[model samples]
Target: MNRSHLGVLIRMVTWPKKVVFGAFLASVLTAILGILVPWVTKSMIDSFTSHIDVTKVFLLVGLFLINVILSGIAHYMISYLGEYTIYRLREKMWAHILRLPIDYFDNNSTGQTVSRLTDDVSTLNNFVSKKVPEFISQALLVVGSIVFLFVLDWKLTLALLVMAPILTVIIVPIGRRLYTVAGETQNEMAAFVGKLSNVLAEMRLVKSYSGEKKEYTRVMESGDSLFRLNLAVAKLQSIFSPLISGTIMLMVLVLLGYGGLRMADGSLTTGAFVAIIFYIIQAITPISSVASFFTEYKATSGATKRLYEIYSLSEEKVDELDEYTNIFDGQIRFHNVSFSYNKNSKVLQDISFTAQPNQITAIVGPSGAGKTTLFHLIERMYTFDNGSISCDQLQIDQIPLSNWRKMIGYVMQDSAIMNGTIRENILYGVDDADEESMVHYTKLANAHHFISSLPEGYDTVVGERGIKLSGGQKQRIAIARAFIMNPKILLLDEATANLDSESERFVQTALVNLMKNRTTLVIAHRLSTIRNADQIVFLDAGKVTGMGRHDELMNTHRKYADFVEGQNLKMAQ
Candidate 1:
């Protein structure tokens, strides 16, 4: 287990001192009350040797009544403390995961990460709410019982003490192995969850391909792994009960037999022997708990390690040059820019270009030419390996990530709409947007008429990834979303590539409205749409091969001229 993560988890907790103190007080009082009972029973039984004092009998009944009352309060108070602690810990864990870099999500599946939050956290919560307070009182009870037994008959206490080492020898190795198995279980459970989520989320594709049986078999592989681990745990647990129970029975038999002989010889009083028996019964309950607690603690420690690892991850850092955050003339310049996901797979080379403020600058390239990647760099979704991308002469990386992203509105060719109402989708990021503004923007994007046609109108829920809406409707909804931002920069990545001609015309009109007075960067496959662009950048094999107006690129760059000629296109602008 990563001990450092344990420290980090502790610091993450938001402790409410009053509740903690109350819970602790209750637990201690309960343990003390528990200890007093056997002691009181001893007094009552010993009194039998004489007159059997009525007052002592009454005292035992009163103690039982008070114990019952305190037990109720203790259970509730301790549970409340545990629940509240887990709540705050989960809140911290959630916020941390959200703040982590996008790459974390890219590497980890939704199921895997969700497992960390839901399953692993629940394990830790079990330890906190149920195990910890239980262990505390159980430990106290066990210790108090042993002390009383020693005073009654030191020889019997020695026999019990001899059993301790033997039990330790039995339990320690089992605990270590259980810890290992438990950790394996957490990992297998995470993988199973990830696989299941992946299959369900894309069930349409599975049905389309007729791969239902194959997917099920794969999911079952993970399920089988989990089952095997569970079986291993059960086998280990099965060993525990019999070993501990046998040891306990052996102790009881010794007390009865040896203690009987001593009483017969008049060396031991009947009342003292009876009291010793009561103490043994009382002690056995907590002793069994102690053994199980070690087993449980080791198992829970596996989950603790997982919790620690998640919280230990480094979050995304943003350098907030506040002065430059909102300031933009939207002149984007790329100088000696180079980037790659890794060393071998270079996506963008030493690229340089500038998109002027309030002008539609188009980047035209074939597939795999890194056009979409350039847009990601400008949005600061990733850091460029070399060179600089800047807006109005200020390097983008120097600006805060949120602030930089806020300045631009990106509408992809296949823009995703979250599962929500049309109104919520349109105004997703704009918190303060009113209904009037949302409606106005929807009208500008040519989205309002269709939205109003629906029975629920703006209140209608767009199914997962906007499945309820057509390609054109989802596109226009995205446009309206961009309009709400009123951004200085707009990125349109083949925004009409997937739409029909009729849908394109409606979306084009909305795009025209959205593009007005914004610094626009467009990545397009068809050269004709961007023929009137203020500047045309031709990217080929991850390098800019052409830069200038369409007419000029046709005259100077061979590839650009060949592309235009290949399309049998007329030269414009």
Candidate 2:
């Protein structure tokens, strides 16, 4: 991650920073207190040989107990604070995710996003709560012990220093390799998670097509990849531990022999020999701990990079207009509008049409006729490349998208719903809808009867994406949602495509009523639905080939007449 990204995360998380800093500060103080215990033992040993001070020995023991108590308390608080910080950070990160643009979600996999939010965040939490405090403790202990060792006997400390350069050299290469492997493993894990999400989301489709074995194999492959990467990291650590232990053992052996000779020569005090052994043991802890700290530091940094990628997503543009004042007289104009999702192939080319105010305009053509693309452009879901889409003689690009969207009620081919009560889903777009207005729209959408018959009536939980409801029921609920929006313009892309004849007739009637006062635009494959439209525009290869009402188009346009004739014959059969 770049410094600016880390700085952004730090800024987002700095609200409870004082608690984190205090916890680290207390942990360092606790490590400092721990060093005093060995010094006290050395003092008690010397006093016993001379004056045999029992009271001083008892005082030293009590001091050691006090240090242990304080250290435990500080460690607990530090850990507690770190965990709490992570909790708050996850919530903050999730909120940031929600505000990000739709394109970000489109470009990324669901599994990868989930992995970053859950696994990567958890890894970062471990770094903050446990590793950070331990790092601080190790630093204080290492520095304090070194200073004391120099005071006791500078020559033995010098001897210990000889191994330091070699350890640093060993750690540098291994630490870098460990980080690289850890990052690869984490990325593999995320990819696995994403694949699982995709399979699970379409579990019904998989089962219907008997794809269980294929899915299982895919998941297993991902697991094997994760296992291999993890094994590589473990192999590095396997070597790392023994190398550090061997170096520490070598230093201890040398210190024991040299110190024994010093004691015999009377160059070092007997009490001081005890202290040096204790200091050497204490020093080993910080050395091993500091090594692990750097190792984890590299791993945590990898997690940080994953998290930063999410935080770095560009936020959606929200209009800064103070008043909801963008006027729309319900006329939509597409003037020489051209668009392509990618630069190579064009989806729509010079698409121009006008849906007059309070008119039911229909767009019809074969599959891939750029029917939906035209709707997307009108909705501003995707901006055009070469021309202007205007409303009431004002350019759409000049208006805030927030206000522009508020003027239209959109219903897609898929009846999109969420896990919520029936009433909640109905009132989703317009939260301030009164009960009478709610009932009126629901009745108009033909959803009121089925909803009232449910066990919980309007309060019935819809389950995830309305899975608890029948497909037809979900479509009615969606229609009611669009109805309640009270928008000046209504945009429907195959709203009745997925419904049975009875449900279709009911929804079509409700939709017809809903479109009465609004400027309605419909994209339909079946010619029957648009036969009564005020204007019908036939699109083929991203351009309008025919334009007129049902009778006029059938008489004048060959494509429109053939499409109507084809579907009419299918109905007869």
Candidate 3:
């Protein structure tokens, strides 16, 4: 194993140091007691063969019972320590994952992340709960048994020592092969999970396109690949177990033959011969257990590596600042700002605009004119490459991300809603919002009437992504969510694009009410919606083509005129 893998194991084991140490001590005591059992049995047999004393027999039986009780208690502690270790590891990992940067989600699939948290963590859990404790107890037993055997008959111990190298030669190579196969199997499982997540998330799209057969074939192919990888692992394990057992049996046979000859010649006592044979049998168990530990360790190592990759990712930086005491004036300016998702292509270039307090600034452009990209930059979801974006003359990058986001409200085209009660979804991030304020905001967004008409009123549950509600109702709920925040700045990204005329009128009215005194930047596709905007900024190919009131742009800018004309023509059609 690499140093990194070893480091992970050491760190995990040491996390609950006191508990782990206690468990270790218990395992050692358990192994010692286990070794004593055979010795006690051998003594009992020898004593019974000679003069039988009731007192001595009772004493021996009492000691045996004590050993059994102590071993059971130690075993329980070992299991407890193992479970606690995994609990701590999983909690730490989950907290770290939740704080990762948003871009991390963009790069990784949901299924893969879920697999790491569920499947990979389970592998680590199994190692801690089963493999670690088993390995420790078995290791101590093997060493103690060897020492006892040497004391009983050094000559028989020498015969057993001869087979050790042969066992190592067989077990080590098989372990390495199992490790490689196990890693492959884990990777294939992750891929299958990713594919499954994609299919389930887009089930509606698949069915709408009548692609059920295609999706079935794709899922089956992924499953088949995973199955084949697991089969390879199974084959290796099948070979590994029997080979170790065969070697162990060979050593037993050789010992039995030699020890029988010694007994016949009066060179070894019968009790001594029986004790040595029992020790060898005891030793065989731990040897097999150690081999199994190697198999589990290699499998868990692969899982640990995957987990480490996620744990090592850089989180979104939040700078420490004195309390943000400055009240936002709702003035936002982008001066010579540029940004790109990739190095080769620019998404926005030299973008400059301003939205003054208590006014509506409409951003109008073609499909790929970087309108939404500008919103993302303003929200600090993605940082700019050049120039400055400031709110109230303070550079945005200087503000703590959490504080900045808290001061602004964003409503997207899709109206994102969680599966929960209406009140819960509205008061999601606003923990301090009272019932009065929630009702007031919902009323303003024109969502209160429909919500009130529901059987449960505000307590009614919105199905997944608010699928139970109408498109307009969902959008209005989103507006209500933003309204309850009472933010100084509001970002509306084509909020009315997907609604019908009647729904648009209702949502637009609610939006106008919500925008009463906020700095609103609306990414508008429908020209009519922005006719009264204080200023309209026209953009094309990542550059600002024009900026003015609607009437001014209609005569002064040809591109703006053409865009207006195209929208009007589409409406007529």
C-alpha lDDT values of all predictions: 0.82, 0.81, 0.81
All candidates: TM-score: 0.93, 0.91, 0.93
For model 2, residues 110-168, the per-residue Cα lDDT tens digits are 89999988988888788778887677777777888888999999999999889998798
**Local accuracy of candidate 3 as per-residue lDDT tens digits, 251-299:** 9898999999999999987878888887898798678888788777766
RMSD of each: 2.7, 2.8, 2.6
Q: Which pairs clash in the backbone of model 2? A: 111-194
lDDT of 1 by residue, 47-103 (tens): 776678898888888888888787778778878877887898999989888888766
Model 1 residue 333 lDDT score: 95
In candidate 2, which residue ranges exceed 4 Å CA deviation? 1-11, 319-322, 500-502, 567-573
